[model samples]
Each structure stands twice: as structure tokens, then as C-alpha cells.
Target chain A: MRILVCVKRVPAPGSRINVTPDSLNVDTNHLGFTTSPHEECAVEEAAQIVEQHGGGVTVLTVGPSEAEEQLRYAASVGATAFVLVSNDTGIDWDPQQTADAIIESIAELEADQGQFDLILFGNESADSGGHQVGIRVAVALGRPAVNGIKGIEVGVQGVTARREVDGGYEVYSLEIPAVLGVKEGINLPRYPTMKGRLASKKAEISARETQVAPGAQQRRRLHQPEETVIETEILGTSSDAAPKIVDLLEELGVL
Target chain B: MAGVYVVVEHDQGQLAPSAGEALTAARRLSDHLNEPVIAVVIGEATTEFVSLCEEHGIPKAVSVLDPQIVDYGPELWGQAMAELFSLTEARVVMATGTDRGNEILAQASARAQIPFVANCINAEFSGAWELTRMQWGGSLLEDVTLDTSSLFISYAHHSVEAEPLAAASATQIESIEMNLDPVLCRSLVQDRVTLSEGTTLSTAAVVVSGGRGVGSAEGFASLEALAGLLSGKVGCSRAVTNNGWRSHADQVGQTGTRIAPDIYIACGISGAIQHWVGAMASKNILAINTDPEANMVTKAGYAVIADLHEVVPAIIAEIERRRGNSTST
Candidate 1:
């Protein structure tokens, strides 16, 4: 049961995030980069599936050259292979171009080795949150796809996926060679060990380049929402604050 | 005629809140574009659904009815919506940024070979579609333009308040027949497992949320008690759910549930960007933490500089005592 996971690199926003002066991108000078939170869980889920099913995990990302850091991080954890589809144009690819590139990459990889049994993607990108790439890829591939899945169970015939709704979980059963857009709560991603880090440093990364066409959506600019300063009133220390809380709750008419 | 089309969401014939929100957004767009508002309801299209649309001042409502589409499948709904768009020739398509909304619009956009933007807070159309959309779950904003002929957009959750027109107009219901293929229905909802019965975290008036500082699953009992006293629901941060202390359904964060309560009492939460986005819509926020410099403490409207374990019980006791005094009086 070979599995493939797609991930994205985003800014690791600590307390606050600022936009560039031109409002075209995030200011990265003061920020660090990490894999999107949901995709980290997707990588972890793929690793767990391979650990139990006796297969290997392949991780891929379509981003700038610096995105190799995220791919290496996946290798350090448990992924057996890493592919970086480099976009050196310094401009973000629209969802259509990204999906097309991924589809082409999948086809080429399958031609070399064999077809993967499963494909995974984060439910949405943490930055853009377009919620389109996975569904588009699945449609183009003519495979069953389920999004916002929190739980998955692999079986002999098919796999069962669970998605959280407003008050309940909606379950779906899809055949193999299917795709899933998973959320963060699916699994807790593990950290890399010293041996794993050393192995990842020596691991080989495959880089591929593809032509990208402009799509229907074009980003014009980026801006920050007006900030509302909130002044916090500290009640007291210890249990003595209980009465103040009660009084405030009463004032808010929630008591 | 060119108009704004809204996809209405319904549950067992009752309208969902997102339906109203979508209608509100469509109305706003119609006001700017000078076009009529058209609603698309996918289901049995009962009288209730039509009447609800009429009450919201929708001039025309399209019902895409088929037996195969008893429940939602993204592909099937998307196919139906694409057909409706062609038949109606609507200019813009809109839906709320809920799970079903985003999924259906995504499929529709893909099938139509167009670009679809999700979680948009504001949209304006002069010649091209200019919009401000939420990025990183509202922590950042991106201004973008859509060069497509037909625009597809989804409103961010709680971005627009649901409002009705002053004078309701009579809605014309139009029924459309669809021949859905069985293959498109392969991803239908098989079953549903309900975690809680009533008063979900999103709809609760008051939310008492705990975080990593709560220690363990057992630590949530105090939060539950306090929530019970306040007639509220218990919510947890992503860290608590990640630690297996609570179910994902009870989590308040970007990936979980976006809650808009009257008051949100955050206990021991550090207020990460993801969690803060979900709780930012609350009318008032009270943070209880031992560390006064925590993000939650600094950004909240009021802070209690103390440990929540002791503070929660004392607050519950005080509420009960006040109730006892009133009853005796």
C-alpha cells in the first residue's frame, strides 16, 4: 500500500504577522517557515499507514526552492522519498497550475515505479485556504475524493473516511486509489530523532520543474485588517478573583 | 438575466444559518451590481424552502431536484449547480464558507474550469472581481482579482450578519430536472455519528474553553461545572484536543469550530493565532491564567491573574450560593 502526501510551506506566525510594504507577500524577514499544520498530520498519517501495511511513503511539495526544508522535515520523520516541484519564479502559483503540475508529477512517478494506492492532501492551505487543489486533482484523476476527513481506516476492499459536520461525523467508504483531504486532528505528528535527522541530511531529494500558466484568479495585493486595541483589566490574584469574575459575568448578563 | 446566485443550505426541510448568511451576502452583491438575487436550493424543494427564500426577498429560486441527490455529494451537487449556472446564466455564484459550501463550490469551479475563492470577507465588481479574503484563518488578508467570466466566491464564516429585506418580495420557484449519474454519487454520506445532542459549541451563547493548562481529561470537569452554572457549553483549544483531553467537535479553532458567543471565558489558553481567530467574534472575553503575560491574558477584555483550577470552583460555588440566597429570600 504505497501512499503519497502533498504538503505546503507557510510562515510560522508566532504572535503577530505583518505584510510586505507592497502588500504582495508576507514579510518573511522576521518570520520562520514550517509545513502547514494539517499537512504535517497528513504526513504522519501516511507514515503510520505504511508502518502497519508494509509499504513506503512519498512526500511532495510545490513551492519555492527553500521548500526543500519542509520536504526534508518529512523525510526526517518517516517518509521514504521526497520530491520538490520547484517554482523558482518567486510568484505564487494559482490553484489550477498547482493541481496540473501535481497531476503530471504523479503520472511521471507512476510510469517509473508503480501507481500509489492512496494519495493525501491537507484539507486546505493554511495561507490561501482555496480548498480546490485536492478536489481538482481527484476529479482529473477520476478517483473518489473526500475532504475534511478526520479519521480513516484501510480495509481489504476500500477505506472508510470520517468527516466532522456541525453536530456529527459523516462517514464515507471509497475504493483504493482514492484521495483524501485530511484535517489536523486526524493524528498527532511526531518529532524527528537524532538518527532520523542525520539520515535526512544525507537523503537524496528529487527536483522537477514545470511550466505554469496564469489562471483566472490573480492576486492583486495583500493588506492587514485594522487592529482594535483591547485593554485587559486584571481582576486579582489567586481565588480572590472569583468574586470579581462573578460580578463581571453578571454584568455581561451570562451569570 | 445576469444575477447573483446563492446556494441555500437546508437540513431536513429546515433552513440552516448559513443559508441566511449566503442570502445576505448575495443581497449585498446584488445591491452593488444592480442585478436580482436568485437562490438555488438542491433537494425536495418543499414549500417551506420556497417561502423562506421569499421572506428573504429573493426574486427567483431554482430547485434542482432528483432522487439520487437525497443527501449531499460534492460531485453531484457541483454538477447540478453547473447545469443551473448555464441555464440561468448568472453572473456570480456564492455560498457560505462551511464544509459543504466550500466542497460543492470547489467541485463546481473545477467542472466549470474556473477559479473559485473561499472565505472572502468583501467583494467588489467594477470590471473584474476584486475581493478581500481571509488568509491563515483571518490572521492575514489577501486582496485578489478574478479574471473569469463567471465569479465563484464563498463568504467567510461569521463575516456577514444575516439580514432580511425590509419589504419581503414574492419569490418565484422554478423546478429543474436533473439526471445524475450513479458514479457521481459514490461519495455520498453513508452514516452520521452524533457526538452531542444540543447546544453545540458554535451556537452556544456562552463558551467556557480550557487549554493545555487544564492538565488532563479529568481537569475538564471543573470547566463543565462552570459552564453548566452559566448555561453554556464547554469548549477546548486545539492543544487540549491534540492531547486527547477532548473530542475534536468540542475544539474552538480555525480547523475546528468558529464560535461567536456572547461571552467566551478562556481558561489557561495561550491564545495561538488559530485559536484566537475562532474566539475573536465573541462579544466579551475573559481570560483566566496563572501567567499574566500570556497571549490570551493580554488580548482578552478582562483577565483573572490566577490558576483556573481554583478559580473555576470558587466561581461555581459563588453562583450556587447566590442562587441559594435568592431562593431563600
Candidate 2:
């Protein structure tokens, strides 16, 4: 089995995020980047599959050269190959365009390998989190697709995967050449070790473009969220009240 | 030019509540767009399915009955919906944004080759879509302009209010039989795996959630008892899962399940952005924490100044007292 895991690099989870100076897009400048935590789990799950099934793991990502870091992170988790599809077409493509590019690039990558087995991806990327790429990729590739998978195992004919539904876990099995959108808790992703990091350094990632792009735009409406965020600040009263605060804190055993 | 296309999701015979919520979204969007709503339910059932839809507020209900579609298969649902989409020029196709809803939209988006957006919290129509999309698990908002004349959008279960219309005269229902190829599909729902030992979260009305501040793994019993008294579900924070205090299934976050309950009470939870994102849409939130500075104190509908040790037991006692009072009455 040759497993392909797709990932995305976005702003680190804890870092402060900002829109561009023009208030148009996420301000990529000044923010640290890392692989989406969910994708990390997907890579770990794919690695476990290869470890048990005697196969190789390949990582796929869609972004600029900066996105190679996500692929490297996947390699550090035991992926053997890396494919990057960039849309340096002087514009940032929407989710559809990104999926199209990934669809085309995945075909070429799988064709080079001659026969592909599994395609694993995060349920949604942290930043874009479009939640469409994997499903679209499955459709574009004409393969079985499962979403929100929490657990998985390799089977004789195909693979067995478990996902969350309305009531409980929905168990499924699909033949090779299928897609799965990995949810958290599927597996505990392993941290990159010194050895795995060094192996990742040696990986020369592959990248390309796609023929399909966003065909048209739709109407409705868009804007910022209506919910208001208010910050509150309260100050302690006078010195006498400060002593009372200390007494109250002592009563609560905070002192 | 304005009409609602309700995306139906089902497993075996039971329909996901979000299916009803999808109909709600469809009705609301259609109302906003000044268009009528049409519901498309795809299943293997022959007769009962059509009436089930007609009883609901779905006018022009199209039931694509096929015997082979026993489980939720995205391709078959997408293909069937695509045929329906061709028949009707739906200005907006809305789904519940569940595992199935999101899947159908993704497949339909690719098949239709149109821009697809997921988990949209707000949408408007002034000729084009000015949309506000959640980013980084709702940590921030991305305001983008989708000029697409028509597109596929899945509303996250709790993101949009599921407001059904008042029952009017008999709703117009239409059923259409369709053809589908079961082969070329790679996966099937073999069985349902149990996540919780009891009380499916879907049935939970009032939920009491815990967080890292709960500290010890041994204290879950107290929380469980409190939840049992309220007939509610037990919820955990992502931190608790990370700490292995609870199983990941009980985790409440962006990755975890999104629920809309009558009342959500938080205990010892500082409320991370991700956790709040999942629970923010709850009808009401009451928080009890030692740290008065906990972020949720402001966000919750009500805040209590007490530790889990001191407060949860009291809440349980109150619930038991209420039950006793009701029984005596």
C-alpha cells in the first residue's frame, strides 16, 4: 500500500492573527507557521498504516514554497515522498481552485508511482478549513471518500475507517484509492525526532499547477460576524478594600 | 430564480437532525431571498419517505427513492442531487454541514465545478454574496466576497438558526424516482460503533462540561453524577483530552461535535477559543469556576463564583430537590 496524506501549513495555533493591512486577507507576515494539527494526525495515521501494511507514505500539500514546511513535517512523521502543488498564478485561488490544483497534482503524482492506494487528509485546514478539498479530491479522482474519521485500520480488500455521525461512530470500509478526512483523536501524532527531522531535511518535495480553476462567482452576501466581543477591566477599590481583597483571597486559600 | 434545495442526510432509516435543520436553513434562506423552498430527500424507501417530507414544511418536495441507497453514500447522493439540481435552478443549495452534508457539498462542488464554502455563519444577497467565514476554528473571521452567481454552501449545524415555518395549508409535495449506479463506490457503512457507554450526545438537552481545571482524572465521577441528575451529557475540553483525563469523544472543540442544547453549564473551564467555538451557539451557558478571570465568565449566559468541588454537588442537590418537588406535587 502506498498512502498519500494531504496537509496544509497555516498560522501557528497560539500566534496572534491579523487581517492584511488592507483588511482583505489574513496577514501572513509576522506570524509563525506550522502544519495544521489535524493534518499532523492524518500523517501519523497514514504512517501507522504503512508500518503495519508494508507500504510507503507520501505527503501532498497545496500552497507556495513556504508550504513545503508542512510536507517536511509529514516526512518527519514517516512519510517517504512529498508532493507540493503551487498556484503561483499571481492570485490566491479559492478552495475550489486549490482542490482542482491538488486533484491534478495528485493524479500526476499517483501516475508516477503507477498505482496509488490511500489518500488521507485533515478534516479541515486550520486557516482555510474549507472542508471541501478532500471530498472534492475524492470526487475528482473518482474514489471512495470518508469524512471526520476518528479511527482507521488496514483491511484485506481495502481499509476500515470509523467516523462520528449524528448519534455515534459510523464504521466504513473502502477499497484502495480512497480518500479520508481525518478528525482529531483518530491517532496521537508522534512528534518529530532528531532522526526523523534529518530524514525530512533530505526530502526534495515535488510541486506543480492545475488546469482547473474557479469558473465563476456567486451572489448572496458576505461580511464579518455579527457577534460582538467586549473586553472588561475591573480595578480593585481603595487601600482598605485591598486589605479586604487580601482577606477574601486568604479565605479562598489563594494566599 | 429563487428556490430552496434542502439536502437530506440519512443512515439506514433514521435521519440526522441536521436534515431537519437543513430544511430550516433552506426555508430561512428562501425567505430571505424571497423564493420558495424545495426539499430533496434521497433514499431507497418507496412510499413513507414522501409523506414524511410532505408533513414537514417542504413544498415541491422531491423524493428520489432508490432501493440500493441504504447507507449515506456521498457520490450517490451527489449524483441524485445533481440530477435534481439540473431540473431546478436553485439559487442556493443548503445542507446541514454534517459529515454527510459536507461530503455531498464537496462532491457536488467538484461535479458542478463551482466555488463551495463551508461553515458559513452569515450570508446576504445584494446581488452578490458578502460572506463571513470562520477561520482557525472561529478564532478569527474571514470576510470574503463570493461573486459566484450560484454556489454550494453548507451551514454548520449551530451556525444558522433552524427556524421552521408555521404550518400553513397542505404543503405541495413532489416525488421523483431516479436511477443510480451503486458500483464505482469504494466505501459503505458496515456498522455503527458506540462512542459513549450510554446517553447519545444527540439526545442531550442540558450538558455540563469540564475542562483542565478539573485537574484529577478521578473526579469525572462527580461530573458524571451531576450530568445524570440533569439528564445531560458529559463534555470535556480539548485540554482534558490532551491530558488524557477523558476520552477524545467527550471533547468539545472545533474538531469535536458541535451541539445546540437548551442549557450548557461549564465547570472549571477557562474556555479556550476552540472550545468556545463549539459551544458558543448554545442557547444558554452557565459557568462555575474559581478563576473569576476565566474567559467564559463574560461569554456564558451566567457565571458562578465557585470551584467544581464546591458548586457541582450543590447543582446536583438542587436538581434532585426539584425532581422530588415535582414528584410530590
Candidate 3:
């Protein structure tokens, strides 16, 4: 019943995202970081599974050294183990390189401890949104994988996963040692308690390393899309605006 | 000869909404690369599917109809696509950037040991593949170069309008034979559970969305009333969901449902980038907030600088009054 969750540290974007002068990375001077929303739910889902199945959850991440903060956050929220596949390089790794590094690290961890029964990942990173790492990892490992999973249930023989589709859900059953990419709506993650925070501060974090190779895709630059400034027509400033709104709705054929 | 391949998504014997859009993208690539475009269908390419393709100006298509692939499985579809890529020596593979579309293409590209890009808005080949893709849900754009000659990419949803060729010829559908491994079926869809019947958030024509200013879960009552009166749906921002005032199912943002309604009524929302990316696709936006300087108010097509609590009830009453007068007449 051992479970592993993979997460990414992303800057919590406000109303707007500002890029660095070089356009190579996000300007992080005043920005704060948090685990991608989807991966936070993945960590929560893994922890809840272990809580009910009588096992431990391991949280893993691949990012800069500062990502250790995210790993510690996971520990505070029911993760029993932490693995940081350190990427000290300032430049972001391509999807292929990231997937390769994660696959190699997973093999190393399994060599030390027994193989995990399940591994979970966010459907896509909030920043890059490549939507490939989990599927690539599963394909390399020859394990069943599905993305956009919102529901999961563990049974005696296999695990049942539900992927949200239009107007319904598509359910799949896979044997143990499977991979899944969970979305944000899967669960509402809990906040860290005082005791959990203290424990996480003292918890040990395992750091792993991988060789970097040039990936097929390389980022040239990042730029913001030109914002179209619309001349917003003010309907009114008080309840009297309601009639104007109704008239506009009628013009839009909504009424 | 190397050709461009586009994977068409279908459901319940009809082409999915993004099918034509994906083909349009492939057609663009095909014209620029001077290669033939072929549509690949994982399921049976029925007469209706062929007609739809023909209507969309598809010149050629390959149908991979295997009994083992009765249900959708990422691995199975990936392998099938991988086989097709090798058999045809495809130069480019494209699909719509959907959950299933991205999954299947990712798996296929992995099997082919090639690079895959998602949410690409534009792509061109000068010498190598240069792509402009949407990052942060279209708030930002990333220009990247794919070193590989064989390209695998997904078009950003709604990036290109679906248009049929000016003079499209009869579409030719050819069935291809492949040896699919049964192990891939491990990821096959085993069951389906219908959550709700019709008019979900994504499909709703008009969406009345609330944000943090809506106050609490109970505060969504006016929103629900407005949506019901408009025969639309009710949505909330991520803040409302995080506050535990609304379920995540009702959230509308980059992390939530990407909605494309005719008109999106945003109430009490400050309009963060995450939320704006989802609502930007709507034809028109009307923001009702007390703060005139809010992002939602400034970016919206129309605005009412007032408290939603006060304005929503008034709007509802006005609509009812207009309706009653028309009925009396």
C-alpha cells in the first residue's frame, strides 16, 4: 500500500505574471512559491490513501534546492518520506530531461526500499504544463498510466481510478505498481498543523542527483501576450445599473 | 514519403468538437511542409465519421479499428499511433490539447523516443521546428525550438478557427492493420459513471460566476438564480473553492474548468491571471464588483461599479419585470 507523489514548485501568480529582463525565467524577487495546485491534491490523495490502508507515503520533487521548502511542506501534510532530486542548474530542464531524471531517481529509491505500490503525479505543471512527464515515466517503466484522474480507490487485486470526461467519468482498473496523473479537484488538501510543522522542520530529506543531457526541445524566450485594452462601458454605479444590465443581456440575446 | 498525421477524437459515433480544429492545424502544417495530411481515428471510422471528415475538408484518413481497443486507453492508442508513425514515416503528429489528446500523444511520442510539445499556438519549419506555445494558460507565450525533424505537438484549444477547405475533395478512408499488444489494455476504460446529464459548466452558453466577493457558499444563491433564469450554469473562482464555500466542480479558472460561454458574468472577482485565462475565451464579460480598479472590472467588456449583493438582486428583479410585461402584452 506504499504510495509516492511527485510535485513541482511553482510561483504563486497574482493578477499578472512578470518575466525577468532576459525573458528566461519568472521574476521571483517578490513572488512566493507553492506546490502546483494539482500536485498538492496529489500529495493529499496519497496521504489519505496511506491513512486508510496502513502504509506510508513518500513525496518526491525535481527542482532547485529551494524546492526543499515544498518537500518540507509535504512532510507536514502526512508525507512520511521526502526525496529531492536536486537540479542545481539555473535553467529549466526540458520535459524529456526531467522525465529521464525522475525515472532514474525512482529506480534508485526502489533499490533501497521495496517498490511502491502506486505512484501519483499532477496532470500537468502549472507553469510549463508540458503534460508529458507522468506518461513518459509510465511508458518507460512499462506500467499502466492515466491522466486527469479525479477519483481513486484501492482494492484487493488492483486500483480503480476515475478520469473526468464530458458529462461523466471514465473509470479504469490497473494492477499495483501503476502510475496516475491526478487533477486538482480530486481532493481538498488540508493545512499543516502546528505539531506537523514542527515535525517537518526536524524531518530528514534525501537528496539525489542525475546527469544532465541536452533535450530535444529548448526554450528560446518567454513573453507576455499583448493585453487588449477594452474600453469598458460602465453600466451604472448603483442598483439602478440592473436595468441597464438586463438591456445589455437582451442585446447579447441572453435574455 | 513523410507526411503529417492528425489524431481525431470522436465520441458516441460523432466527431468531438476539437476534431475539425485539429485537422485545420494539420492542414496548415501539411501545406507548409508540402506533405500529405492523414487523419487517424482510433475507433471505427463509420460512414458518419467519414462524412464529417469530408465536410471538414479531410483528403485522406486512416482508421485503426481493433477489437482490443473498444475502450479508450492511453497506452493502446499510443502504441497504435507509434506504429502508424513508423509505417508512414510521419514528419509531424498533431492533436487537440485535451486531457485525452495530450495523454495519448505523450505516450506515443515517448514510445517513439521523440520530443512532444503541448498547447502549441503556432509552429513553423525553417530548418528545424520552431513553435510558439501557450504557457500559464495563454497568459504567457513561450517560443521554443524542437531539435528533432519529427515533430509531435498538440494545438492549443481554440487557437485556430475550424474552417473547411474552399474546395474540398471527397475524403478517402483507409483501414490500417496493426498488431496491438493486449498488455496495453490494462489502462483501458473499464466503466463509465454519468455524473450529470446535460449543460455542464464547459458547455453552458451563459455562465454566472462568483468570486471571493461573493462572501460565502450561501452567497451563491443569487448567482444560481441568475444562471437558472438565463438557462445557463453557475461557476465560482478558485478562491471560493479554496475557502470551502464552493466545491471544486464549480470552480472556473486555469486549474478548474476552461469555459467558453457566450457571455461570462463575473461577480466580486478580482480576476487573477489564473482565473482570467479561463474566462478570456468567453465572447463577452460583465464584471459586477465594488472596486472599480479590479482586474476583472478593467478587463471586462462591461462593468457595474457596485456591490454584487446589491446589483444581482436588482438585475434579477428587472429581468422578471421585463418578462412579466412581455407576457401581459
Candidate 4:
């Protein structure tokens, strides 16, 4: 019944995103950082599973030392233990390198505390959106894995996962010791309580280092896409604009 | 090293919408590389599907028809693709960046011990293969260089328009027999549960969407009313869904439904990149928000700088008034 969840720290973007002057990274001078939305839900789901099944949930992240913020945030909610696979967190490790580092960290954790029954990850990191790290880890571990899962039901010996499809959903059943890449909306993450905040401040975080080199995909630069300039006809303001809206709707033939 | 490869996806005996576009992308790579375009189709494919390949400029396709391959199994499909790559010696492999497409390609890349890239908008060889891919949905772009013996990538959804060759070459479907490993079917799609009956978010003609400024679940009532009057559907942003104000099924974003309605009325939405990617496909957009600098307001075709609480009811009343006058007359 033991579960592990992986998360990443990402810059919380506003209405617009700007690249660094060197074109290497996101300009985060004016932005705050938060756990990727999908991974936040993953941590919540893991906590709920342990609450029902009576097991500990361990949160893991492979990023720079600053990512300890995300680890502590996981503690504030429900994660009982934390592991940070520390590296130069300023830059992103390609998907292959990231997966390799995670697999090595998982081995070390399992050596200390028996094997985890299930491991969860965000469907994709908000910033990189590589969509492969979880699956790559699953393959390397020789376990069944599914991505884009929204619904999960733990049974006695297996798990039922539901992925959203066009009309309904496609369900899959995998035995224990499996991995899953869950998306947001799988569950509503709970807010941290005052007592939980105090406990998280005292929690100890274990750090691990990775020596894996960068993979084949090397980024040259990041840039904002050219915005299409639209005139954006402002009809009016407040309720006075209602008549103009009706006229426009009529012109568009929706009325 | 011999040709460019594309994995064709089909469901219920018809080609998926992204299949033709993937083939067209492969055609571009094939022509540039001066190599043939070889499509790999697992399981059954209709005649129309094969014709689609030809129309999209695919020179040859390899089909594997096996009972175990009848259903969608990520591992099995991945193995098929890995085998096809070795069998064909494909120089580059690409698929559409759908959930299934990304999964199978990732699996294949893992088995082949190669790096894979997703959501690529464009790629070409300039001393090296330079790729321009979408990051943060479609709001930002990243220029990357992938140094691999055989390239693996997926095209961004709806990024490339599907085009037919002016003079299509007669496409031949060659049967490449494969006895897939039975163990690979462990991850097969086991069951299906229908959440709603019909007229889902992606299929709606008009979509009235709400965001964090919608306040709460009950606050969505006005949006629902507007959608109901227009016989459309109601959608919300990820923020609203995360706040427990609406169901994930009602969310509009990169992780949720990608909708292309006739008109999308966005209320109280700041329009983050994730949400904008899904709504950008709508033919027309109207934003009602207090912040005139919001991304949705700036990108919209029309805007009203006011609170939706006031604007929505007024729009509803005006429509009803006009309807009553015409009926009375």
C-alpha cells in the first residue's frame, strides 16, 4: 500500500510569459514558483490512498535545491517523507536524463524502506511537457504503466485506472508495483492547515545527487511565439454594452 | 536510414483526424530527405484509410493484422513500432501528439534506447536536425537540436494543416507479418465507461466558458443559462475545476478538452496559456472581464470591460425582450 509521488517546481506564469535575455530559460524575476498542477493533485491522491489504506506516502522531486520548496509544500498537505534528487535545478535535464536520475533515486529509497507498491507522477511537467519521463521510468523498472489517467481505484491486488477518451473513458487494470502518470482534475488538492504548516517546517528532507549526462535533445533557446495583432473592437462597458453585444451576436447569426 | 516513418491511428474503421496530418508531415520530411515515406498501420484499416495515405502522399504502407493487436495496447503498439523501425530502417519517426500517440512513441523510444521529443511544430536538417517545438502549450517556442542516429518526434496537435499531393502516387499496402509478444498486451484497454450520452464539449457549436472570476459552482448558473439559451455547452477553465467549482469534464485547457465551437463566450477568464490553447480554435470569441489587459480580452474578437455578473443578465434580458416583441407583433 506504500505510494510514491514525484513533482516538479515551475514558475507560475501570468497573462504573458517572457524568455530570459540569453534565451536559455523562463524569465522568473517577477514570478513565483509552485508545484506543477498535475503533480500537486498526484500528491493529494497519494495522501488520500494512504489515509484509507494505512500507509506512508513519500514525495520525490529531481530538480535544483530550490525545489525543496515544493517538497515542503507536499509535506504541508500530507506527504510523510521527502526526497530531493538534487542537481543543477536551474536548467532542465532532458527527459532521458531525468528518468535515469529518478530510477537511481528510487533504488536508493527502496533499499532503505521496503519496495513501494505504487508510484505516481504528473502526466507531464508544465514547463517541459516532455510526456515521457514517467513511462521511461516504468519501462526501466519493468512495470506496467499508464499515462493521462484521471480515475484510480485501488483493489486488493490490482488497480483500476481510467483515462479520458472522446465520448467516455478507457479503463486499464494493472497489478501492484505499477506506475501511473496522472493528470490534474483527478482530485481536488486540499489546502494546507496551520498545524500542517508547522509540521512541514520541522520535516527533514533527504537529498540525492545525479551524475547522468544530458541526452540527445539539446535546447538552443526559448522564445515567445509571435502574437497575432487583433484590433479587438471594444463594444462598450458595463450593462450599457448589452445592446452592442446583442447586435454583434445578431451579426454573427448566433442570435 | 532508408525512409521516413509515420504511425497511422484509426478507430472504428476510420482514420483518426490526426492521421492524415501526420502523413503529410512525413511526406514533407521524405521529400526533403530524398527518401521514401513508409507508413506503419497496426491492426485493421479500411480502404478509405489506405486511400487517405495515398492522398496525403504516402508512397508505401506496412500493415500488421493480428488478433492481439485488435485493441489499443500501449506496450504492444510500442513493440510493433520498434520492430517496424528496425525492419524498415526508418531515418526519422513521427506521430501525432495525442495521448496514445505520445505513450506508444515513448515506449518505442525506450525499447530502442533513443531520445524522443513531443509537440514538435517544425523540424529540418541544417547541418543538424533543428526542431522548433511548442512549449507551454502554444504560447512559447523552443528551438532545439536533436543528435540521434534515428530521430523520434511527434507533431503538435492541429499545428500542421493536412494537404493532399497534387498527383498522388498509387499507394501500396504491403503486409508485414508480426507475431506480437502476448505479454505486451498486459496494458491493454480493459473496459469503457460512458460518462455522458452525447453533445460533449468538443462537439458543441457554442461554448459559454467561465474562469476563476466565476466565483463558485453556483456562480456558473448564469453561464449555463446563456449556453442553454443558445443550445450550446458550458465550459470552465482549469482554475475553476481545481477550485472544485466545476467538474473536470467541463474544463477547457491543454490538459482538458480542445474545443472548436462556432462562438466561444469567455467570462471572467484571464486566459492562461493552457486554457488559451484549447479556446484558440473557436471561430469567434467575446470576452467579458473587468481587466481589459487580460489575455482573453486582448485576443478576443470583441470585448466588454465589465463584471460578467452584470453583463450576462443584461444580454439575456435583451434577447428575451427582442423575442417577446417579435412574438407579440
Q: Pick the candidate with the highest TM-score.
A: 3
DockQ numbers for every candidate?
A: 0.70, 0.30, 0.88, 0.72
CAPRI band of model 2? Answer: acceptable
* Candidate 2: segments with Cα more than 4 A from true spot: A13-17, A28-31, A87-92, A207-224, A228-255, B44-57, B194-198, B305-310, B313-329
lDDT of 4 by residue, B1-329 (tens): 77888888765466776888888888887888888888878876568778888787676887876678868888888888888888778887789888878888998888777778899988888567888988877778999997666878899878887898887677788887788888778888898788778788998888999999889899989888888888889999998987888898899987788898888999999998889988987889999999999999999999999999999999999888998999999
Model 3 chain A: weakest 10-residue lDDT segment is A83-92
Candidate 4, which CAPRI tier? medium
- Who is ahead in DockQ, 1 or 4? 4
Q: Is candidate 3 or candidate 4 better by DockQ?
A: 3
Segments of candidate 3 deviating more than 4 angstroms = none
Q: Return whichever of 2 and 3 wins on TM-score.
A: 3
For residue A7, give model 2's deviation from the true position in Å.
0.4
DockQ of 3: 0.88
Model 4 lDDT vs. the true structure?
0.87
What would the TM-scores of all predictions be?
0.96, 0.86, 0.99, 0.95
Residue range with the least summed lDDT across 10 consecutive positions in model 1 chain B: B9-18
lDDT of 3 by residue, A221-247 (tens): 999987788999999999999988998
Residue B29 lDDT in model 1?
Answer: 91
TM-score of 3: 0.99
lDDT leader:
3
Q: Write the candidate numbers in order of decreasing DockQ.
A: 3, 4, 1, 2
